[model samples]
Target: MEQLRVTNQDREHVVEHVKAAYAEGRFDELEFEDRLERAMTARTHGDLMPIMSELYGPRGVPMPRPVPPRATPARMHTGPTESPERLAASAAHGLAAIGFPIVGPLIFLLTGGKTSPYIRQHALEALNFHLTVIGASILLPITVVGVVLLPVIWVAAFVLSIAGAVSALTEGSFRYPMTLRLVK
Candidate 1:
């Protein structure tokens, strides 16, 4: 049995690796819990290195390389460029307007309004379409007889809006369905 050396930095790095692996669903429940426990118990970098090597070695676990940070786009020199968050918001807005308006505005607002203006603009347009559809439906005689459908539409919109909001906050690029491409 060869003893492995660990240093403080190695332990911290190992802990991070283990956490990332677990988050990526590479480990089953038992393995995940066990690995997490081991990572927590790691005291020094040297101690952690060996443990990590063992876990990731043949017949053990496989660890992936850390993801590099994405480069931030430089500020637009002219007009505004779309951000990932904004792209997602735009997508959410389109989905919401198409009878799922619930998620668009929530995503737009929750993203600290820092998302791309393009996304916000698209979402607003979608929202407008959704309102128009609801208005048209309400004015129809058959829709008046089917008043229960009104609540269903509202609920659907609310749910979609919430989803869009969360995605924006998380900086995800979501695409709205059935929306005109107003922004490139």
Candidate 2:
């Protein structure tokens, strides 16, 4: 396999995650500094994997998603988009508001995921986002400040869901910002 290079931005991203884990009390001062150094100097995505695994579980570190080869950009938009696929994709995002984040995305994932790339991508994005939210909800309560961010996260999730639903309605493939691609 080709080596996956990490850029300064990637290292910075990992640094932020390490800082959050520290704020959540996942690491002590010494360990936090050590992790921060490692994240800052990481040369490749693989170098950051163990650092994330230390915060989350082994499965939490997401591998790079392989883009499917397509003959043309038109391949992405040429499929049937107005019927069950569009509605299902929209529902995948909207269901997070009703508390079926994991289930709702999985439903469409199992139903149309194989036949519809659009639905599959949305379901995967929603699934990863909810997983991150749930993980944050659990960790943030450990600190007084994290407790405050929890409600803010809740509102962001709701508003983002509505936005994703709108994008789905417009037949656009939408991805949530700052989302860990764990399911991809």
Candidate 3:
């Protein structure tokens, strides 16, 4: 058959669907990743067919997610609130501050992150932040200036981790400067 060409939107749509499935516990990490890579790289209708088919079994409409009860904040600015999701997010950065390179974010990623987008984003950010720090630590020791900057980097990471934890707890978003997103 002459295949219909796919566009970037088509590929992105498929990827989003796969992510939703993964988030909803329909697919495992390995399976999600394999499907994701294929969806992202698919070239034509033939390429897209199998992915949607496997996920929905020939259904045309995507599965609808249940509506969550909305929480309206009284003010634009809010303080730290105790929640399982927020606690997991705070731990992602707090543990990083204590010098666990991957363990902290890994914990969040494995736990609340699997289902919560909010937690997942924070975990990925923390993981990327520390990965960047570890990479810089290894490469910076070679030069005199780099050696001088090494301790500075550590201090900055320390401060940033605290900031990340606070922001995460308070329903705010925090991003590390110069972080490379290797995980996402």
Overall lDDT per candidate, in order of appearance: 0.55, 0.82, 0.86
Tens-digit lDDT string for candidate 2 (76-136)? 5644546788888889988876789799998988888988888888888888888888888
TM-scores of all candidate predictions against the true structure = 0.31, 0.58, 0.58
lDDT tens digits by residue: candidate 3, 11-124? 999998899888987767999999998998888989988999888777766655556446666333343354977888888999999989689898888888887777888899
Lowest summed lDDT across 10 adjacent residues in model 3 is found at: 73-82
Which candidate leads the pack in lDDT? Answer: 3
User: Which ranges in model 1 have alpha carbons more than 4 Å from their true place?
Assistant: 1-115, 118-122, 175-184
Q: Where's the lowest-lDDT run of ten residues in candidate 2?
A: 61-70
Better of 1 and 3 by lDDT: 3
